[model samples]
Target chain A: MTIEYASIEQFYELIEPGLNSVELAVYAASITTFFALILVLYKRLHHDKLNTLPVNISGFGYAIPGTVLAMAMLATFGPLDNLINEWALSLNIEEPGLILSGTVFAIIFAFVVRFSAIANGTISGGVEQVAHSLDLAPLSLGMGSIKGIFKVHLPLLKSSIFVAWLLVFVEAMKELPAVLILRPFNYDTLSTQIYQLISDEQLEQGALGAISIVVFGLLPIIWLNKNEEKS
Target chain B: MTHLIDIQQLAVKLQNKTILSDVSLSLEAGDILGLVGPSGCGKTTLLNTIAGFIEQSAGKIVIDEKMQIDLTNLVAPEERNVGMIFQDYALFPHLTIRENIGFGLFNLDKATCNSRVTELMSLLKLTELAERYPHQLSGGQQQRVAIARALAPQPKIILLDEPFSNIDARLRNELMIEIRQLLKSLNMTAIFVTHNKDEVFTFADKVAVMSEGRILQFGSPVLVSQQPNSWQVADFLQLGSWIPVKCNGDSAETAIGSLTDVHTENCQTGKTESSIMSLLVKPQHIRIENNENVNVEINHVGITEQGYHYIVSSLNRTDLSFDRLSFYSHDVFQLGQQLAFEIIHHEYLMFDQAPPR
Candidate 1:
């Protein structure tokens, strides 16, 4: 129950040693964010004339619950490291975070999952504004919609980006089940930091993290709500 | 040459409700067709359908004769080369006025786009507001920007759906005058959908009178106003006196009197061979004629501030009939005064009780 951090030489007593470095990287590569990113990419980049997938998949209503998603994340990523290493070899990428895994990758994938509707809504609203003004077809006016996202759309999305940044940041900060099962070795985020601290009888540190999150989270929630009201 | 824009048997069914049905009309070069109807009568629906925003359930929409596409197979709204000003003018709040007008001209060369934007800004007198966002502009300014944006693409047919409703009513008439002039100078073929009678009369070359998803009449504004086909139409256009009548083949007798000038009277009652029929009379055709031998019993006289009195005449036939027969004049008459009135002339149009035979 007592974990030692003072002496770097005594690491073997407190660690799961048999797992090698490559095996550890593979373990971190599979999780909710990885799978969620797949759904998000399909939703965003699909070019079908009739788009019914994004909404259906955003799981605005039909999402598998978080616990089930956690279970799925574990099963999908836990034993699938060999396949990941094999695929990673084909792509010639040494690091897994570039394509999948850990806090940064999980956050990226989680964002696309939890926030695609907002992204699509923002994009569609921009298109609608131009379409209606020019009497253009909302569909036919899809002129470089992909190119536009980087050129004209991103500039126009200042407010959207700021809001989305706060959402993704906070969600990634507070995410538990995904982060709990997906952190790299010796990594301590504020969310997992609080959960681990509390479990180890450090309630004050945990409470401080919880309090900081509440204070920071409340500000963005209010701002997001107000932005929506104005929009 | 074919008309600039043509629509035939266009029906728009949305959310299981028939918003518009079999409404066919066309706009020639330089023609401004005003689609006038009461609220929810499909005027806006028809305009949106023509602009390609709403898909038509049936019928053909031809643009410039060469692009004859049944709206069922319509080119998309953006590619249709049509323009529109919505009821609210729906200006983009984020874009500056200049950018808005320049948006649809994205295909043009940069120089061409700039010149077109400049020309439209001056054309709409929006030069001062060019840097402002839509929310910063006044209703009239926003309206002009909307028009300028729509017009920048030089669309074949401009569709204006209740364009002035968002503007101040006091400014609407003056703005309409400016818009009408601008459209003429540009030789723009437009369909202006509005419910206001005066707006339609003053702005449109032709009018389509509609109610309950049906166009009662469509023609030059004067024709639709002066010679509406039925009582429903007469009521919609605020035309004519709805005189009660009983008629047959030749002569029709209304509350006012009997008339034998039967040209095309379809009486709902009486034998077709008989000379008695019921018909409606135009208000302008019924007048106070003391010397012409037509008797009118006045039940009440309503006076306006301008000293003119509208006489509400009572029918001796119906006893308690409020026939709503009124005449415009400055001479105030007393209530219950039996006045001598007569048929103004042959302009009194009589209709059958129910149409056909």
Candidate 2:
């Protein structure tokens, strides 16, 4: 990390050669998995202007056991990888696994399983509240009751989402298994970079990386919660 | 203009339990029929059946005679051109007033749908609310928009579950007047269902008075008031009870003096000695004694918290000594005050045990 060879080109060469499938898979899954999380969240929530990277990594980033979701993603992605390989063979192409594992498919598969559960829970909870407004049947009467909820239900809940996003953001900064198994080799996310430096016992450098990720996570949550509570 | 709806003996049984027992009625074009009853008395079930939201277990509902829809015959609510206004005014919250009205006119051409919505908005005075969603409006405004939305499609028949229940009491009368006028002027066959007797008298051209699960009386407001079929009907209509009177021909010998106007055949004429023959008298017919002819004493008096709204009657006559008569007067009377009057008219007439038609 400190340029032992005293040359930037040598450092770059040393970093680039040691990349393997495990690292490639992890980085690919992490970034694409983050995008997939955004997609699911976008479908469930439309009003929030907050970005998805902080949310995707922080909320369930560490909560999702990387081994289980990673294994599941591999199984799901295996068929698609084979199909891509067959197409590559038909076209006499050199790379097939690149299309399957190194691309967005592997990452999306892992994150979808996580976010779908969250989206389903959130949407259904809001819908259940609308159902009990009256004993009257659901066709229109139940749906009619949700309008008022849609308004006041927002500003009051902004603080909660902000806090949740912040806590999850910090957690994502420290996520281990998911960062280890999902990231692609060539990629260097903040979490993975910290893991690499820490693994080498580069204490000062690893500490710096860790501090940056935590700061990134906590700042938004505090700012949002404070501003919202003020309003 | 024509018969918009006709139901013949609508006997409905739900889960082996009878909900409606042999119900039948019809509405002509431009007629506003009011269906009145207590809660859970099958009024809403009847409306749901007519709207094709429920399949009756028995009987027939013929719309225009060509469509022989009945208890056995099933039809979806959306398929039938019956416009329904719910008690709570079920306006779609997600949609604006224009969209709500437009939703009903999906089958119409674009220009026609737009024009129809505009016309209905003007008709119901909902022009300003066309762009507003239901949550933005007050109860009265939401009700008007609901009416407008139902009217936009111009269904052959409209069903108003409870036209005034959701609106404030001060505005209920005005809304009733406007709704009645709208129904009449548009020549749309409709039904107004309510438990309030006053709303029935004001808003409906025909009324079906129901109790339990059966209609006690079906006729104009005047007939239902003047001549209910049984003692129960008379009582439910608040027309007072008929006391026991011995009659000779048309002249009846009873309490307060000999009565002459009642037909003798209407009373039990020839029965055993122990057979009970009861005479009918309304509270209004019995009066406070001001003259020295009859001795009277006030039992109780005071304006009730409910203002006596006159729905509840003070018990003036007992079964042994005094007779009851039906009366209509807005004036408040004190308890124990001596009131004197003659039986000028009847609140309702009665029939022998054979039961009236």
TM-score for predicted model 1 compared with the true structure: 0.76
lDDT tens readout by residue for model 1, A90-207: 8997735323443345433443454444444443444433433332322223234344334344455456445544544444445565556655667555566668778999765456
lDDT score at residue B27, model 1, on the 0-100 scale? 81
DockQ metric, candidate 1: 0.19
TM-score of chain B of each: 0.87, 0.85
Worst 10 residues of 2 chain B by lDDT: B307-316
Which parts of model 1 have CA positions greater than 4 angstroms off? A1-68, A76-161, A204-231, B15-17, B71-73, B211-214, B267-278, B289-313, B317-323, B334-340, B353-357
User: In angstroms, how far off is B84's CA in candidate 2?
Assistant: 1.7
What is the per-residue lDDT of model 2 for residues B66-124, given as tens digits with 9 covering 90 to 100?
A: 77785445765555677778887766566788987776665679999899888988888
**Candidate 2 lDDT (Cα, 0 to 1):** 0.62
Worst 10 residues of 1 chain B by lDDT: B348-357
- For all candidates in order, the CA lDDT equals 0.64, 0.62
TM-score of chain B of 1: 0.87
| TM-scores, all models, native as reference | 0.76, 0.64
